[model samples]
Target chain A: MSTDLLTEDQREALQELVNIGMGQAGASIAQVLDEFVKLSIPRISSVAAANLSQEIVRLVGDADVSAIRQAFTTEFRGEAIVIYPEQSMAGLHEVMGYDADTKENKGEILLDIGNILVGACVGGIANLLGMLSAFSAPTLIADQTPAYRLLKPEHIQARVALLVEVYFVLEERDFRCHLIILMPETDILALGQALDRFVDGI
Target chain B: MPLSILVADDSSIARKMLIKALPAHWDITVAQAADGNQALAACRQGNVDVMFLDLTMPDLDGYGVLQAHRDEDLNGLVIVVSADIQEQAQVRVRELGAIAFIQKPVDAGKIERVLKEYGIQL
Candidate 1:
């Protein structure tokens, strides 16, 4: 069977839905950080497997990066992404009330932050989809790489990905991040149906 | 009788959500703390029956707070609220003497379940 990729309209609607979700996410993050969080509407696009990394780098710009990722499974399943620019982790730590002196606690701190941010983002999406999503706890990945790097080789080879870039700004700091929602092409139809139900209810 | 509770979380959203999830009928006075230090202070200054402590904080984590007050004769329950779901983390917090472990993005159902399990009438 041929893949049912998102049409332009479907893509636009999904992007808007994701933006609303990210608005809630930004508010949640701001509250944790105790600073105002400014977020862009999130630029949405689709990319083939081979060009995924280059496209992400171009969109986010050249900077040392860290990412918090979580996979969400509804009736439809996909990955959600939240990336941070270099040094923003420190800002996050400050928001959580940690200082440089506590470097030993980085793993715990990073994981906790990732869980909160990614959980909120994915939870918001699940709400929009009108589905209950079961999530695996969030994981933090450092080093600038695309989402595919973390995926199984079989997944990278077979699935076309939907990438949504949600740019976040907190206080005076700027951050470029992306939420990549990827599904097997076979699941696109089911995803579209779910999105339709969600939009109608909203 | 109002049960005084202290809520410690770094995220204002989590705190707000937990407050909202409290049973409206319960006679309760809520005090908020942004981190463990404030939580410790609240425990010292006022009567707190239960504390909802977030595990991850800057100055002192939930574990640190529990350790600090472990020997205190304050009669209250300490429920650790965290996003870390790792079994080891849960086991460690339990070993540290948390009365209960609650994962974050707390909802009404979970709270009700916990209250029921603890035999606390909400």
Candidate 2:
């Protein structure tokens, strides 16, 4: 699975698919928070699995990273990530209504938001693709490391990765964050035919 | 007169939603299964006429449940209610002899589509 493997048509199809997935995810998040959430332009690209973390780091730029990684299974197994700046964790905690005294509350808040955001994102993507995917519980890690290194795929034995990155902005608050999903190269290839079917039908 | 159906999914939210969305005239006797193995077992018992199965669950998952439905030569129409809506899911559901594959967060239109699949006019 080369980086340039997706053709113009496939690229367009995938872009639309990501757009739908993100929009749905945003809607669900909005419902959960009772606020309006906007999704930015989602960028979709591919890389070797070994380069996954590096590619993610490049896309995410330099930020103190707070991430939750969740793995999903089905015919195609991969990881879904909700990545945010360490700077914004407190704001996110506020938005999620977690004003607690215990230091452990922060970790709990991080995992809760991550789980909601990542699960909805993955579930929404699966819904649009007509794919069956089940998610594991989300794990939170607030590390000032590179995005890729912090949330790389381990369970999937694959050669390439398809990464979709999008920004979620909350209208009622100054909270905006990144949501990334990594699909195995083979999974994307399998989805390629599904995309073709959708495109053909349309 | 009514349909004998099995509704199986690990998510209580999902199962409850489907139960609430049932057509008023269905007059249905519903059996519920919280996971894949229970779904498979219920379908194998040969009591239900149709099963609304979820693909992702704790024990068996949807594929295994469908396989069991086939292995026992069971008689029932399967409608897959899943969040995984990829084309492969659709093809696989059809391959496993499902009458329809409906996406999650099921709404009235989706319910109508399933009904249409079952030869209901409206």
Candidate 3:
């Protein structure tokens, strides 16, 4: 029995797959905004689920966080998360033409934006992986500190999370999001097969 | 006779792109709205043969537009044009009575194809 979670090659391949998925997403967003959308894959890391939130804050920031998340199941099931700072959501709303006075609708607007982004990102992943996955309606989470605090107790025993950090820039605006793929150790093989199918499809 | 189309989206750039992407010789009248509420009001005044709606908008989203007009006995075809291209999103909009789905950035080829599919000739 092998104790290794994911061979380095597998990690690289998975990261490459995620990059491709995000590329499609970026293109779609650029088209919608009628602007050039640039995306970069800054880093990929494997960490314990217990430290996921802390590591996220370190990579991005500890400020108010808004995210769009969805789950996909093929050989295994895992969540795809995209996190952006709270201020970025306001910028996004502005781009979408919401009135300045409409700030009160931030929660729903943020959820919808996240829904579109995460839907595209996760859909790209599912298409690449050759998996038939459905997405649940998106929900918004505000204030990462409290959310992480709530999640801390349940995440303590979990180990090994696959984190992919992406930086997106729309003209003058700079924003970052993390696409974290979480799966149990037992599902690694299934994930590999899904990746294999995904690569072949591309 | 000039055909009229309603273009609804929150992004000014997107609206401009769609206008630029339309065929130069297509004898059509274009009506633009920034959101669903404005779109609904425009539809009430008639002369709308097609609608290009973005799914994510403040005030009212694309789905709301569809719902508001579903029973209005309007003569226009509702086509959902959005950056949200996930299969699920497409399915939802189609279920809401959209006649067609065109992904964002509005490619000329895609627009041509969809127009042809719906029997709208330039």
Best by TM-score: 2
Task: Summing lDDT over every window of 10 consecutive residues in candidate 1 chain A, give the lowest-scoring window.
Answer: A144-153
The parts of candidate 3 lying over 4 Å away from their true place are A1-4, A101-104, A143-157, A196-202, B1-122
- The residue pairs found clashing in candidate 3 are A128-A198
Write down the lDDT that model 2 would get: 0.70
- lDDT over C-alpha atoms for residue A108 of model 1: 57
Q: Which whole-number lDDT from 0 to 100 does residue A32 have in model 1?
A: 67
DockQ of 2: 0.02
Kindly list the per-residue Cα lDDT of model 3 for residues A1-202, writing each as its tens digit. 2334665556655655555466567766666655556555435566677677777777556676766566666556666666666555546656666666354566655566566666666666666566666777766544443324423526534466666676666655654455555566656657766655544433
lDDT of 3 at B6: 88
- All DockQ scores: 0.02, 0.02, 0.02
Residue pairs that clash (backbone atoms under 3 angstroms), model 1: A97-B58, A98-B58
**Over the stretch A1-202, how does candidate 1's per-residue lDDT look in tens digits?**
2233776556655655565566566656666665656555456666665566666567555566666667778877776655655555555555567676364455556566566656666677677666787887777765444433543445464456666676666545643345565665555657667666644443
Instruction: Report every candidate's CA lDDT.
Output: 0.66, 0.70, 0.66
Give candidate 2 misplaced runs (Cα > 4 Å): A101-103, A141-148, A151-157, B1-122
Interface RMSD of 3: 12.8
* Worst window of 10 by summed lDDT in candidate 2 chain A: A147-156
